[model samples]
Target: MKQKVAVLGAGSWGTALAKTLVENGHDVMIWGNHEKQIDEINEHHTNTHYLPDVKLPEALKGTLDLAACIADADAVLFVVPTKATREVAAKFAAVCQNKPVVIHASKGLEKDTHKRISVVLAEEIPADKRQDIVVLSGPSHAEEVAVRDVTTITAASENLASAEYVQSLFSNEYFRIYTNQDVIGVETGAALKNIIALGAGALHGLGFGDNAKAAIMTRGLAEISRLGVAMGADPLTFIGLSGVGDLIVTCTSVHSRNWRAGDLLGKGHKLDGILENMGMIVEGVSTTRAAYELAQEMGIEMPITQAIYDVLYNDVDVDDAIRAIMLRDYKSEQEFTFN
Candidate 1:
């Protein structure tokens, strides 16, 4: 059964998602901010700006006009970067013809609001008209998904029915989906894992090898779980796909923008140098501030997250940051909260 779907953002992840929908036999319309990207996907079946080699399907059409693209769609996939989510969602809501199920694919806390993505959606689009809201997240990278790599993610909504509905939208041989109702745990896990990913990337930047990365990843979860559990998340959710699963992949995977940003910084490049080269929003960059503030407010101790914060915001030298992390007073792993 074909359903009309609108995908916002023509970035790598958005393009990959649009491809999945088109291949699933949906009437997919993509909205790109750039005229060239819109032209590429609409007329040429490709987005040269992001995924260069992957050929998009003809079933996927692109447009720069947001209202025109989403007017008749049954659902809209918000795939824009976290920084742009609010502005785009506001414009999207203004011209929305009918409230369709909104599926947001971005991960990061709003710097200004400290609000979760779902909260932002609920605020921008009235709940009654918003239909259903769901978020899909996991270790899946856009490049790998574009190449048809085996990827699994979790679909989370306030209600299980909505989660299951979104689950059916992306399930295929190459892409697997799981449904969960813990939206806070799922979204928190998604956002905080990026900070840990930065720690892992810093270790990699220092040439620490797999053993160091594995250790960092394990301990990193301790911090992620501590803050999340304190804030009302299911502890078990952190052990699932949205938590450890996403953390391991993003930290170790070469395709992760956040990890790459940390890597560039570890190699002794300044923040400006890194941001200039990447040319994409590294969400962890902004979320680091939010996490630091959250941890302070909640009275939670997150050494790894703090170190990344220092390195990114305070201009702490990456080498000194690593040394500081290594020198933290030894205590039993579970002494603070895990046990």
Candidate 2:
């Protein structure tokens, strides 16, 4: 079935997914606040600022009118940055009349509210105008997926049917999506892994060897899994694509904005300078603060996340933060003991 899909935000991920939807034979109208980018997508079929060198599917339309883009669509996908999620959702709520399946491809919690993407969407988009909310996340990067690289992601919803419907929307050979019921686990893992990826990049910036990176990756996963579990996420989800899977890719890949930002920070570039130069949203920067706050609230011990947060916010020296992490009180590596 060819459905009209409204993809909000014309960033790399949004444009890439819109291309995928068009290739899958859906009518896709992308919405963005940037007029120049929207014009480029419609007239040039390329988002040069984001997905340079990739030609978007010609049929993919771009619009600045949020109401027009989403009106009468079968589904809406939010791909904006975390800070912009609420504002977009509020505008979308005011203009959209159809009760389409709500899906968000962005990851991160609202800064002070400490709410997940789904929660932000739910708060703004009324129940009557929105159907079951779904989250699409995993290790897939927009640059890879833009070129039709084989990528797999998970579509999660509390409603199984909603997840399956989303799975049907973009399940071509090049882009595969699986459905999971653990929305919390999937979203939590997707949001938190960026923080660890920052740490990974910092380690690399510090000229740490593979052993150091390996330790950070392993211990990072432990801390991520711990916080996820504390927040009602399934620990096993962290091991899956959204958890460990997403972590490995973000921590290592040049395609990851978070990793790149951290790499810059690690190389002695200041946070403000790094972000100003990157020209993209490095989610982990904001996520580190949000996750740190959440961990404190939940009484969860997430030293890796804290260390990164302190480095970014508290002006703690990366070397001192690392030494502190290494010298922390020792305990059994395993979370549980056999009786």
Q: Per-prediction RMSD in angstroms?
A: 1.3, 1.6
Measured by TM-score, how close is model 1 to the native structure? 0.97
lDDT of each residue in 1-339, candidate 1, tens digit only: 678899998899999999998888888989987887788777888886678889999888999899988987888999988878888889988888687999998899989667888888888887755787899998889988998899999999878888887888888899999999888889999998888887777777777898888888888888888888887889999999999999989998888988888877777778888888897888898999998988888789988889889988898988898789889889886564443
Q: Specify the poorest-scoring 10-residue window by lDDT in model 1.
A: 330-339
Give the candidate number with the greatest TM-score. Answer: 2
Enumerate residue pairs that collide in model 1.
none
User: Evaluated with lDDT, which candidate comes out highest?
Assistant: 2
TM-score of predicted model 2?
0.98
- Model 1 off-target regions past 4 Å? 336-339
lDDT of 2 by residue, 1-339 (tens): 999999998999998999999999999999998888999999999999999999988899999998899989999999999999999999999988879999999989889988999999999999999999999999989999999899999999999999999999999999889899999999998998899899999888889988987898888888877877777887778878898889888989899988888888888999999999899999999999999999899888888999999999999989999999989888787762110
